[model samples]
Target chain A: MKIRKINPAGQREPPAERPIKRRATKIHYGMSEIVITIVLVILALVIIIPLVVPLLFSFKTQLEFAYHPWALPKAIRWTNFIEAWKAVRIDQGLLNTLVVCFGSIICTIPPAILAGYVFARYKSRVTEILFYAILIGYFVPVQMVLVPLYRMEVSLKMNDTLYGLFLPMAAFGIPFWTLIFRSFFKSIPREMAESASIDGAGHWRTFFSIMLPLARPATVLAIIQVFMGAWNDYLLSLILLSDQNKFTMQLRVASFLNSYGTDRMPRYAAAVIISALPTLILYLIGHRWIIKGMLSGAIKE
Target chain B: MNVFKRKAVLRTEPAKRKKKDPGRKVFVFLCVLPAILFLAVFLYYPIEETFRLSTMKTTGLSNEVFVGTDNYEKLFRDEEFLAGLRHVFSWAFWSIIIQLPLSFFIAFSLTYYSNKLTKPLQAIFYLPNVLPSAITAMLGKFVFAPNYGLIVSLGKALGWKWLASIDFLGNPDLAFWSVFAVATWAYSGFYVIYLMSRIEQIPKDLREAAELDGASMWCYARKIVLPELNYPLRILAILCTVGSLKLFDLPNMMTMGGPGNATVTLGITLYRHGFINWNYGKAAAIGVVIFVLSLVFTILQFSLGRKEDETI
Candidate 1:
């Protein structure tokens, strides 16, 4: 009877262990796994080729591009970039874009941090309503406000100026950034605030000294998102700023495309690359943070 | 008298705490005041103005005589405006049909079967998203150029003679699809990353348990993974719809909504009406329509999704 019981128990153990081993092995090198890997590689190539093609085309002359559109450049044409720079006046555009991006960031971050702290910590009916009211700003499309905004800018004599762009961009950025900041602040323990208050620090003092320092991750996330948005903005810049000299990189690139009309492929390619260089470099360095910030809104538990 | 005294003491204690922190209310107000004021001016004021302007007849931004519903009437009758609405729906439809599935596939593959190549591949997929929309538009223009474009060259190499003369952006029927294709290519990477992040959050032990139960990959994904992803997917659907309504830059840059209003989305139409034709009133009407449509669609989607959840 002992032998019989042992045999049945031992048989059950091996069966359970066998299936897990089988599953482990199947996950590692099955035919389905191989097929999925191959498919993923193909999909990766599809995405990579489009991006890399433009970069490669930027280095070739128009003649080389026309003759061998798929091949790498035989001789690099560095002047393509120079001509593109002159044609688009990208130096001016880049400077304007940088100013707008940084200025808007400066305008947006502090207000967001302050407002977010208040909304996150303070509990009241009025504050709750006000928080939702601010969130309504997120749903308002830029299209809905473009006409009136243009009029407002013109009447205020803010049209065609970088500061003009900065104000609206910063204003529009507030709702989303505030939401991110509020969520981050909420994650901190209430005791932190209570201790500060007990130690004789006021709201602003505690916020500036302690809370703000703890909010580095959210701040980094906000800065990256806001900078990218301001940098890549095309519609507002196009409508609000009429002056050729004040065009952002996107606006300059659009007008350049219209005038260049696809004839100067190499030059246009170079212009595209140059316009995207700053954001691309930033993205390469801070992609993880950017992705985290972006997914925060959708993935909140 | 004793019960009354106890109640009095309780009320007084809380009142005393409130009196001690009287500065907190003022401080909160000061903290939120700037953002509230800024949003009120730039965002809320303009939205209110757009609604007000939509009801009036105006040559430009000023001299509004309220001709109620005239602009809305004109908008419905306008062929370009109607076409713009149709194009936006189609764009949204195609985005849901094409972009969502493709992104899900790529994201699922990367998350489930991660290898050394996953990081580099993820970066490459997201490259288009980081690039300026103008550059993305330009790349589309290059790829579809009839003369020396990659598509044409590849077609020739494959001996597909019909593609040599195809003007993808210039043709009316093709212009809309071409812009849609470019948008899908440019934006899918963003969704891939989004879904991948969500998928990554699923507990490894659960997945292992499913595997140990001898669950097929499809069974595991369908039974376990997809249910967890339902909420994020719903959010994604709403974003995709709203985003499609706001499609402007690519169509504006590539075809300029050309070949007879083929690719003109609501945003492009509003832009042209306001800035190009200087018809502020008509533009405002279109803006109202876009807003209403987006709001209605979001409500409908939520209701529909809720019903599905209830049934499940």
Candidate 2:
């Protein structure tokens, strides 16, 4: 057996004609790689310490927290959670948050899907104008409407009611959800809709039977985004629901801080953790979908 | 045979399409009407009401006399409102100058120098984003508490006696920066994920080719990565601007815009005027200003983005 070689002019030469030498490329880990990795590790630690330290403080007694603020608890005090839970009315807040989240989701999703489906499938001058009209809703800052909304709520006798918050929350949620659902619906092949029409299915029938079932991912994305928005909302709940009994988790935590004072560091820490736990759990499970939704929403034209 | 048959079918389809169904059009309109009505009631109506209120003087909710631009003039002259605007600009400055770069660096490092630990590290970095802003603000308050705060303890451990009793949130000079720091901590993770997605879109082969040509990492980043990220960076810049202008929750929760309104933002000012002071007209004026400012910025961003696209 003989090895072949190529000449500079691109002609093949016989093995007997000449011998060639090849240099092996070596891969090495240099100082730059080490420096970059170390820098990244430091950055990661900076982000993690802030999140984890508060949890550790939550387990300590007030004295323990004061004495060794940076140390892990020598003995975990589960009573801190109980104390914080009662002081902050975590049970009521949690219940209100759940109700608001569910109400907003139920109110927002169906209308958003219907509107999105229509926008995606139907084309006309009216639909185009209506679509842009709704898109403008995306840029309207909540501050611009807060005063009027308050007045409206007062006049309508909807202030301090869960349903009052639900209506506006669902309304604010529509623009984003409609945009997401519209894009998702547009991605579905038109052939499905045409075939459904050929089969004599009405618009609602086609949407319910074909489009909604295929929009599972978008639905999940919408639910997660809207649930987090409504659950974590602070300013709206603060202004709208002044009744302590109707307070959401965010308002409860804020009120706890104001009333409980800063001396009770451990209890405050516990309250903070409890307030954030649901969102944390949701993110841990559905982070991929959350990131996907965020990126798609941001980058989409 | 298939082509001939499709031609015959295509010729007959247009004749059948001549009969348009008004019922289908009406059904489509009905499907979209609910959303339109919701927006009109909840969104557009309030905006129009804000504009109307801004032009009037309200004693209570009912008594209104058109005052022309008096409220707007008062907004510019009001010291606290001016301070709120200044603080928001400062927040935007820090966000654009510091937070954006920090997030970009983390994202770039994670993508280019990733190893087995990268995935877990990304999740950890983004942990703050998943938590409630209110919780994060509370956590920030605890971290900067005068006596037992993590910062105070760290300073004491490092033999810095001056930090032993420094009040971060109570000092007028330090309150705004303190709240700004917490805002950065809570939200920078969002941008990290955003920039990471953009960086991921850059072609892998391009980077590899540059490396094979003996281009240094700095050269590769400057020549290939930065240019590729141009559009997302622009979008992120606009988002950062609009988002900072709307800053409310963290400052409201952490400091209540306290220490003499040091951390007050436009949103906080609106909240104060309407809810606390019961000056609906003044608050409506502030609301109008914020809306106009955000709209102007958005329009500028779009036009700038279009120009860049054309130039490229």
Candidate 3:
């Protein structure tokens, strides 16, 4: 956490030597900076074009896009949005999405907290072994488990139900959630728990009343992340819920695109936008926490 | 105190002297049992099944015979399977070549620009990571249509037919790059965000010291920042390597390894064999191959990652 002072220009680092040669090289480079800038700008365009163009095209009349492929729509076509929404039964699918998101969170987060507590608070070797055994699940590809999960669901008569999607989603997410919560819990000073213990509070009382309150920030971040994951998931919903009525938004969008054909491309675009709205809103509100959470998990290494 | 202790001793029952709390034990069990059961049924069980299926031969509606290592043998001889492996390697090769450096450059710019434009620029770049791969691929498909793509327009103006001259996803030589491009676009942002975080963590003293010594921007960048980014770069290399080996979505979504198996990767090949063709045994064999490859690379990754951490 301590700060250090280092100058960018005057450092003894080998890279500092290039400044004198930089000007001469620039002249020799012959408008190379401009070219490079243009090239990078184009590359940026290429990367962003797909995300932007369709969004624009989805608003224009197909005829307009055909006539002027690069121009903005002369008129805003609100109907395209509605048509796509209705075509996908966005209403029902949104409800289904909400259910899966909240349901999975409901099923997973508490267990993650409890498991995390055990892993954090206990010293038994069995706990460590059990925790690693669970961690192995995170490495296996979802495809590898899909067929077996499907078969099991069928046998259990849970197929095509919200619970079917909820169970697997929750199961897959627990390892990550548990890891996050454990890390959070580990960061909390044990003195707090000891103090509570000395005060004659039960372990459960200390955990719920003291430690849980301390973990609120991490808990909020976890819930948002787990919700986004469950909400945006496609392959699980694709395999589990065969019925249209039961489909989550992602599967519904795929089905809508397939059935509607390309003529209604605008509507498909609208459907895609609608499908992504919850995530977009979630990101806008909690973008800081999401990025920080991801960095904490991935880049801390 | 002696009198009080005597009274307490008299009141203490022998039955309660050795009482132990069962609550914590029950709590541990309750917390872990569901996850264990889930993994056993869902992950480990399927893996065991895949291993079993790899060694078996089936002929009838309900027939399976043990045939040790035969599926793996067939896998090597299958030209298509080998082609898939080659395909995956090529895609990974191109993605690493283009995406890694590009991500670093973007990260560098985001960190170094250090001006009014930084936050908005970083946010703009982070957009692709949140959007699902499905949407990203679909958008890539839209932009790559020769007549519609901006590149096609530029090519037309330049009197070049690069857009129409090459079938992006149809040609064997070109489809790999097409899928790789999409992969790069989607993942480069992720790496950029990753590296930017690391860059931010680099002690400012290094930069200040370099600056005090009259280090040019380029010098400071090449010597100071790049060295600092070494750990993440190594991580990115391992991640991209294994990720490309197990590459599935972009290829599957954009090309479906298509225009005649041009972009078919190990993952797509596994799916095509196991799920599509109902060749469960062969698919399982391919799964075993992928699993082996991933395991070896992952172990290597962990070691390298560990060493990098130790140095840091």
Question: Which candidate's DockQ is highest?
Answer: 1
Give the C-alpha lDDT of model 2: 0.82
- Tell me what fraction of the real C-alpha contacts between chains A and B each candidate also makes: 0.66, 0.65, 0.23
- The local distance difference test score of each candidate is 0.82, 0.82, 0.72
Which segments of model 2 are wrong by more than 4 Å? A1-30, A70-74, B1-20, B301-312
| Model 3, runs deviating above 4 Å | A1-47, A59-61, A78-92, A256-281, B1-21, B58-63, B146-166, B308-312
* Model 1 regions more than 4 Å off: A1-29, A55-65, A68-74, B1-15, B157-159, B297-312
Model 1 pairs in collision: none
lDDT of 3 by residue, B78-135 (tens): 8778988998777667667888898888788667656555665566567677766555
What tens digits encode model 2's per-residue C-alpha lDDT throughout B1-312? 999999999997885465336567877888888888889988999999999999988887689999999999999999889998998887887898988888988898888877897787778777788677778887888788777677877887677989877899999999988888887888888889888988987879998788667577778878998888887777778888888788899998888899888888999999999999999999999999898888877776767667665322
CA shift of B137, model 1, Å: 0.6
lDDT per residue (tens digit) for residues A75-171 in model 2: 8789889988888887788899889989998989888999998888888888899899988887788888999999999899898999899888888
Share of reference contacts kept by candidate 2: 0.65
Best by lDDT: 1
Task: Give the Cα-based TM-score of candidate 3 against the true structure.
Answer: 0.83
Per-model TM-score, in order, reads: 0.91, 0.90, 0.83
lDDT of 1 by residue, A14-121 (tens): 345556766676765577778988888887777666656667778888778777766878887799999888887877888899999999999898988898998999
DockQ value of candidate 3: 0.29
For model 3, give the TM-score of chain B: 0.87
Better of 1 and 2 by DockQ: 1
Candidate 2 CAPRI level: medium
